[model samples]
Target: MPHLVLLYTPDLETDADIPSLCRALADTMLEQRDQAGKAVFPTGGTRVLAYPAAHCAVADGKGPYGFLYANLRMGSGRSEQVHKAVGDSLLQVLKRHLDALLQQRPIGITVQIDESQAQVYDAKHSSLHPLFNRPA
Candidate 1:
């Protein structure tokens, strides 16, 4: 249920490659499972996407600015520490992915991990969950 959506300014398109970033994020979640001993997300259920806004304004309306905003939405069952772990791990990936952009210019990256309310949230999954659980 961990779905990450990335929104960036137009100029950062070069640094924010959607397909590659998505795979990286999915791998990061899998790494959490390997390290923390928990299924952070289903392999087939991980959804990481990127969207470049048509119009964006940051700081001031002076020069071209780049911004990377990642929002992670998941089911509500984890502790604050777990949330921090996810956020930190995700931030590391985003930082590394956008390192060159940041080094060459002034860019901002933010990662926000949020939980969905169990009462209102609804989901539909498939047999892919079992596929992911199969022995490697």
Candidate 2:
């Protein structure tokens, strides 16, 4: 179970880039696995999921802005450093990608990590997810 969940608003240009970002995240997980000696994934590899139903509040009464939600899961073995590293890597990549998409438009990016060992909850209901789902 990848403990990290990286969320972001969809790029104004294209939302298809999310899959590529997910791939990069998976690569990072593998690198981290090699360095940390703990499987980032309990199974063969990490499970990366994407959501196209993101809504961010917009300026007028118009509504939420378009966004893409990328959920990448890698078993972290409950390591705090791993959690931090995951956030760091995801943010770095997301920042670069979002910057290109924003094109100087006002935007915000955020990453959330779940380190709890009890159980994995739905990302929709997850506290971390909503925090990043703020108005634009």
Candidate 1: pairs in clash: none
Pick by lDDT: which candidate is best? 1
TM-score for all predictions? 0.86, 0.60
For candidate 1, give the lDDT of residue 34: 30
Error of 2 at 83 (Å): 1.3
Root-mean-square deviation of every model: 2.2, 11.0
lDDT of 2 by residue, 8-120 (tens): 44444364377777677666665665354765553333456654436545445353344433444443365677667767877787777666555645555556665445555
What lDDT does each candidate get? 0.80, 0.55
Q: What TM-score, to 2 decimals, does candidate 2 have?
A: 0.60
Q: Count steric clashes of candidate 1.
A: 0
Return the top candidate by TM-score.
Answer: 1
What is residue 78's positional error in candidate 1, in angstroms?
A: 1.2
State in Å the error of residue 66, model 2. Answer: 6.3
Give lDDT tens digits, candidate 1, residues 1-136.
7788988898777655667777888788767743457776767778888899998889986866788899999877777777888889999988888787777878888898888875564768587678777889
